[model samples]
Target chain A: MGRTADYTNERCSVAATLEVVGDPWTLLILRDAFAGVKRFEQWQDRLGVARNVLAARLKTLVSHGVMETRRYSERPPRHEYWLTEKGLALSPVLLTMAEWGDRHVYGRDKSPVLFRHKTCGCAFHPVLACEACGQVVDRRDIERAGPQDLTAPTVGEALDAVKIAAE
Target chain B: MGRTADYTNERCSVAATLEVVGDPWTLLILRDAFAGVKRFEQWQDRLGVARNVLAARLKTLVSHGVMETRRYSERPPRHEYWLTEKGLALSPVLLTMAEWGDRHVYGRDKSPVLFRHKTCGCAFHPVLACEACGQVVDRRDIERAGPQDLTAPTVGEALDAVKIAAE
Candidate 1:
């Protein structure tokens, strides 16, 4: 191993996010979620993941508001987990990372969970662009346009959502 | 106790990248590279990392052509490492991850690195936008203007880069 990896003691935002979603299972969970895997048993079956690990990841995501648990069956006290807005917002991040992987790591002919634009009816890259100008943009070009109101106690980050709407 | 995360063996690209760069030392090394930390000793001092691990990560990145090693000081037979175009291309990925960490893990006021747009002089979100419309784009709206000469093994993807680009 090149470097000894440690995240438990770090107080960085990426680490914080990673603390919840950095593992193979969590992302795969989200991947399945995006691919329409909602039920816990379905996730367990599709991913071939341990039940304990799946339960824990779902619990953590729910605790963090990345996912929500809704009662689907009253008799069995069964609940269905769904992506919250916060969870759904991660689509772009996942797509971008997937694209990056597809380009550099995966086989050239690997099949990806294809995404099609609902509005324009086109298949596109997971890119960042200016809505007003239609040109590609980076982190340096956008500004925080919404209020910051975090519910949790992050090391340094606020819990409020920053609107991505470009000015 | 939290969840168990081992990204190195995962099949996803983020996991694959993390297997290479997600570790603290590798990230710090890349951080130093972007920060102009080229010398081996400099990385050693700045990151408080083991010399062997540092050497290994560097070698690995160089092998992948993410960074290139060049002889700079002939007097001592010394060499320095610089990022390749592929490495430079990772700027957005790094920034996006860092931004996520800063926003979710660390608080806004405590962000380690601050990015400002040179042209507009404003803080921006490392967002993904559409190349055609120049608007903040999603995955669905983009078609792959894929690689021109893909010689790597093909998996099962149906469309080629040319076809994706033509769309």
Candidate 2:
């Protein structure tokens, strides 16, 4: 299949994020990283992904700072991939995707993997909640603002805006 | 680029879900659907995606029951695509992705489009929480279990297991 054009110039945040981890291969690779699979050969074996493709995806992740490489052995110069904070934050996305699949696709009563809340020591389903009011957020609660002026600010400006908004 | 092999036979719920919505283009189309872009033309205009690819994606979503086409005009025989319940369930996935982009990719002070918790009437950020105990779930709280038997059960068996587990 032909690769789609990059969304580098797109102002949508989703598009921007997709630029980094939107591809299925990339997401699957991240899934393995979260599962504690590190070595290159391990990813290839577990995912059954093409060697070149896996190599490419890993390289992209490292370049984007989602994953970091560490040398584990000196004899053969072995390296392993690990998730960074930014990458770890993607857990919600993965969990939610799995939950959806379990409910709609798998028709399963329980998920293949269950998530436990360490603080409470109970199995839990992840949900979206409002940070300000701590209320669950639904589709009806969201709307696109500045729809006509969809051009998003540059990354620096966005960071500044977030800071100001926080204040 | 060659397409990755399908995970249709995979027993993992995540892989199953990826089989449906894992591709970047497919996910992007879903994102547009959530954003209220329904018509084929509108999607083309907004996404700049190839016509054949867009058509294929729309067809796939419709076939999977994520989207349904309704005739809006009989004279011109035009149809508009709308999200089904299963499709609407994907809101969290899209929101999480956009939120990720806002925080990491854009470095924005806030998301370009803000999500409001309509029930609470407050701007919100989505968070993962445990359903069993209602505690917030952190990265450290999660671990993969039954790694030796990664294969998940069929729908019927899974449902039965869930019921038993509940007891």
Candidate 3:
């Protein structure tokens, strides 16, 4: 299942995003790419993923505009994969996942890698906040706007039409 | 593949996290669960996923302690899935993905659903920030500690050993 597995008609943004980077191998590849592992053989050696699957994933990511290939050497015509602007934007997603694993999977004392904020020189964890008020938001702090029914008529219009029909 | 597909030998936190909820369908099912779609039938209806796949995903989530099943109806013995504390902690990961999609996949002008911070009554976008300094941390503003090699000896001992070997 490549790009065709996308939930194209789904009205959810998360679903849309998952369609692009939802698979484990893809996510691992992206993680490795962020860690400066660019060569195809390096990724294969690092991830232990099958060559065909890696090739397909690289192709899918490139097609999705998440990554781009560049030729570094002309002798053997070697190409390396690099994250595009869109792909770099996924850093937070991966960071949050690692943080979650650090907290839940491995105890806090045994984190594999620590993320330090260069500005503050303090090791820190990522948090979701209200961009407007800068308040840390949790599931309870957030509310969904409305039902995401793309097939249904707008609620207000539907209600008005029903009222008119009754009248 | 189910839980057996996990990269258990990999010491990376991100890889550990991926082992839990890496598949596209599992992520979609978790998305639906976060949206308060608890009933099995509701997940089936919302995701349009095959029954067997949905069952496997739900079972994996339960085994991983991300979700739990509750007896919702005693008459028909119906059960509903609910996110555990560990699962709810994944909100940031999901929210980040949605925000990325809102920016890159779907234009900002046409978001499917909006997330509002109930505490401040303001719409919010999730951002990755340093928990200590409360500053937004970009990829350049952060540094990875070191290679997450499980096989590596302790850093201090390994360095001493390397020096001894060199001597």
Candidate 4:
């Protein structure tokens, strides 16, 4: 059974972002958007998603301002979904996810879809780089400048006393 | 009512990855993994997730090979979770998601957690770049180097045939 997941009570941004676009369907629709996909029919055909589900997802995206509907055909009342600046910002999230899937899930060069750099004509992946040095960063090179206490053990002192029963 | 979502039948890497770590709790766990939190107790304490729920999430991660458990205390039989090579590769995904959440959800400099580059003594954000040129790439600058056809309009020509019904 699908679970009813919500992070609204959490103050974390990831939780908040997930609240809006965390669903696989929503992410998939956004993936299509990066491909310049527009129109209700286009998303339905590409994703093979049910019509109502697709419509609901699109509506959610629009309400969140990740996407907007523009009238493409006046007489026909046809509209197309377009990514807003906020939506466009999701490219990295999608790209990095695809890359992870490509590397770990599909193996190198096996995934069907690829993002190519226009300037270099080379296939590129997302890199986490330092803004000051432009050097690629690894976990070992970074530290948490936390505004919250991630170190405090919240389970209680009684649990901490259980080191004698350890495992 | 909650709905079950699955992309198992899809060939997409993103979909495949989602099948493994798509749940909000699962991602939050991974985010904690990147932060160097290893013990079950640490995750439980930090996330405030239900014990059974956190246990289940940790089990899923371990079974998927994203994480591994190591015996840490011999007398107590204590164990700790650590990221595997495959799991470490997920840092970019977590980082990027956090960046997106910070920028769009919480606004700049407001996220309680910030990743600071130790080398540069500066806060850094994830950027997608070309491997060859190393310059930042945008959607308009790059085109899909597809091994698949994303340009195909799927909803049937009869609907698109309504161009005469212009909006």
Q: Rank the candidates by DockQ, best first.
A: 2, 3, 4, 1
DockQ, prediction 3? 0.40
Model 2 lDDT tens row, B52-158: 98898898788667899999999989999999998998887888888888778666445567655667666556787666655556767865543534566643454
Give the clash count for each candidate: 38, 4, 0, 11
Predicted structure with the largest lDDT when compared to the true one: 3
lDDT of 3 by residue, A1-167 (tens): 35324475576667667767876688889998998998999998987888998999999888777999999999989899999998999998999998987777765636668877889988878887777787766778888766665753332333234336536
DockQ of each: 0.25, 0.46, 0.40, 0.30
- For residues A1-167, write the lDDT of model 2, one tens digit per residue: 11665565466667767777877688778877878899999998888889998998998888777888999999978899989888888888888887787787656345566655667765556777666666565667765543434565743355445446546
In model 3, where do residues sit more than 4 Å from their true spots?
A1-6, A149-167, B1-5, B149-167
In order, candidate lDDTs are: 0.58, 0.72, 0.76, 0.72
DockQ of predicted candidate 4: 0.30
Q: Which stretches of candidate 2 lie over 4 Å from their true place?
A: A119-121, A145-167, B119-122, B148-167
- What tens-digit string does per-residue lDDT give for candidate 1 at B1-167? 01244443334444444544554455556756876778899988765767888898899787656788999989979999998765765666655565565654454545544555544555555667644344565444444334323443232122133234435
Better of 1 and 3 by DockQ: 3
For candidate 4, what TM-score does chain B get against the true chain B?
A: 0.80
Candidate 3 - CAPRI tier?
acceptable
Choose 2 or 3, whichever is better by lDDT.
3
